[model samples]
Target: MSLFVTYVLVLGRSLESSRGLLELLTPALELEVDDSPLSLSLHAAAIQLWCLVNSRSFSSSDKILTEAYSRLRTAIQDPLQRGCESTVLAALLLQRYERFSAVWNQHEQCHVHRNGALALLRQQKLDGINSKHRGYLISQLFHSEVNICISKKISFQASEITWLRDQDLSILPSNPSTALDIIGASIASHQHKFTLLSAEEFITASKPDLSQWYQDLQDTEDQLNNWPSTVPRHWLPQTLQSGKHFDQSIITYAGYSDIYPNIQIASIWNLWRTYCLLLLQIKLALLGLFPNLDEPTGTTQDPRIPAFKVKSVQLAQVLVDSICQSVSFHLGNYIEPTSLSELMIPTILCTSYHDMDPSHISYTLYQKSSLFMSRDDHRRHVIVQGPWHMMGTLSHVLSILADSESHIPVHALREGQMNWVRTQFLRVLRLLRIDLEDLSATNQDHCQANPGDLHALNTVNSEIIAKRLMAALAG
Candidate 1:
């Protein structure tokens, strides 16, 4: 009945299943358990959060979580505790709790913990932390913070942390070079200080300048372009085809049975492409060569804009295809339940960016993702971090597609084809417990039909509907 007892039970179950995670925790658990009550509480809370997230037992895990937070708060009150090992561990535990719980209201608390962790890192300095447990916690906190900042579309203010930038790539077993590259790109994307351009300048390119902003962009672009050469041949996506139809096959990677490396490589590949696509868009926009999504009054006056749009579409297609391949490959492997959850958020983003057309592979891939999300337990895997929800991202993407349908003629499908896609997403939203009213009520005219009309009951089944929708779109 007590929080400790419940946590112990959950930890026991976790140890039986996840040897990798348990291995990561063993040093921390061993070093902390006998040190103090606070250390033990922090370790227990971190384990509980991880188990609850993978188990999808949000409701039952609240008691243990509450106790964890209460103890963390008490531990942080002493001024001398600022750079202590236990204090940093507690902050890291709270950060994990915020990530796993995925509650909107708790996001600010997540930020609080993030800031707390950064401050601790700044105070102690990375070299000062003698314990391997403390070092691992620091690395994780930095990784998680960078990811959080990227998802939120904000600047990572702690980009000045020397240790993170100075980390040796050769020392790391998995090679986090790609992750670091993305973090740099993310930080660069938000550098609006030197230029008069707003933070949203990347999207609109309202003002053009050649300052530190341009330099940062160029540096990131060079890094991305040069990345493939640095990758070991074994780590690279193997060529599946060699000749005329090479692009499609080149996008596919050789499958791996090892889930961790497979995920790491696939995620790095996808994120790199996504950022490259984004950078291209920004560059095209700056050069006044980006096509407007709205109805074209005349045949594209500038040939460059249309060409760039074609390139953009190609990049988006590659992103979607890569995600599908990653998912399919991972699903084929024997994986733990939560091994795929971390990939879901970025997968949703990449899929949404894809401009759907009958000929494009994205149409089929999107359908597969929809069906995946419709599974009974799949919705729990939808990660919630600031301004990003799986359903919300999906809805936003659908809205864009629906809007674009009115401007660019979609001759691939019969009448009401787009409506069916909308209905499919409506079903997904309902299943995920997201309110359709929130999306549709704001702009009733934004969608072709009311959410009320798009019910799951009218469809034969999700898979059949998906198949029919794909068929209809193809037609």
Candidate 2:
């Protein structure tokens, strides 16, 4: 916790006085001459934005803003194509939103971050953009708007809520519980999705979020696909019979053959655990209220599964720390001068934050449609079934990492290793922190001692998650 606070202040102070930052404010803002890598460039830009946002003087900050805006305009107008133009634009926009405190005032010029974000959203809508990039843009737009509304303690517009709900329908995971109900002809006409309505809507919605009792289906698929031939037919029985060591056999049953599977699994789980912890830590740092967590506990008869679930939150935090250590360890081994290693924190944060979209859980969107309903029923759909959908996905990822034999060394990746890095683990590190561990652990423990029906409600990690998120914005 102290480490995070110290780092924040150190980085903040340095950002306010960086020579390169000052140079960026100069008439000529030069791109590094060497091909330093797009990730490096993006990270540099994020850091510059952070400094500007925390700057006391708007004049010093304006230079960064103008330069960044200029660079973005150039990219948009460039005749020669670039590799990640949309990413650059999105980064700039996120930086813009971060600069505006989570409040809106009519007295100030509406041309700054908040309204500018609204304009960007409108522009995307007008352009009919539907790519993944556009999806992220819309998500950020709604997210920023929501932040403003929450800060102001006001009711956001119904139309904007509808836009988010509808967009979520296409991008979020779906389930039977999120299906529509007959509120009234007029009321239903105005609002079809219950999730779009206020907190009261969730209370009244019928068949609430009864998606499933399992972990990530995608992970299940991946585990099956990557199954090692050496795994015995039964993991528990065979391992117990060996009496030599169940831990080694558990790894084998899951198809893991690494020399240090325990350490490896610990590292992986610790990374995620630390990520959640960091989120919580940041929340406390910012003195923000935690989010609500009233969802029902997932019912699974298997005792082992329940035990594992109980440790989910703690496990997630541990995983986050392990990830940081792993990445840092690898970076230290491969990179020279050591100074570049610190850059990984910001780079990983920005990149991973972009990866965990509610839309990614497109696999189980409509698993619980009525027998009478058609397979192609669109009305039954909902965007992310709930926040737990993501939790389940993350849990499954941890399970997969626990089972796999893939090694992520400093210099190179083993076969099947890059896939995990590409799909989930890397991104989780960016947007999460250590504090989420306690929140998750609490839920998991509660479920363990008293198991029953639990709706897929989000936990107290929201405020914490938001804070860790600010760290990314700092980048």
- Mind giving the per-residue lDDT tens digits that candidate 2 earns over 1-475? 1222123222112211121111121111123322222223333444543443233222433444455555545544543322332433434343443443221111211324334444544545523433334433343444444333322223345334445544444442121111110011112121122123336644444432311201222232233223322222211011111123212212111222111111112222332332233222222211111121112345324333433333433443344433433332112111111122333332211011011232432212312211112211111110001111222233333433332221112123233332433223222321221123424665545533532212232333333343333322221
- For residues 117-212, write the lDDT of model 1, one tens digit per residue: 677666666555444445455555555555444444346664444456566533222334434544443543443231223346544544323334
lDDT of model 1 at position 75: 60
The segments of candidate 2 whose C-alpha lies over 4 angstroms from its true place after superposition are 1-91, 94-115, 123-133, 139-162, 167-325, 329-475
Model 2: ten consecutive residues of lowest lDDT: 378-387
Write down the RMSD of candidate 2 (Cα, Å): 19.6
lDDT of each model, Cα atoms only? Answer: 0.40, 0.28
Q: After superposition, how far is residue 232 of candidate 2 from its true place, in Å?
A: 26
Candidate 1 has its poorest 10 consecutive residues by lDDT at 13-22
**lDDT, model 1, position 350:** 14
Quote the lDDT for 410 in model 1: 28
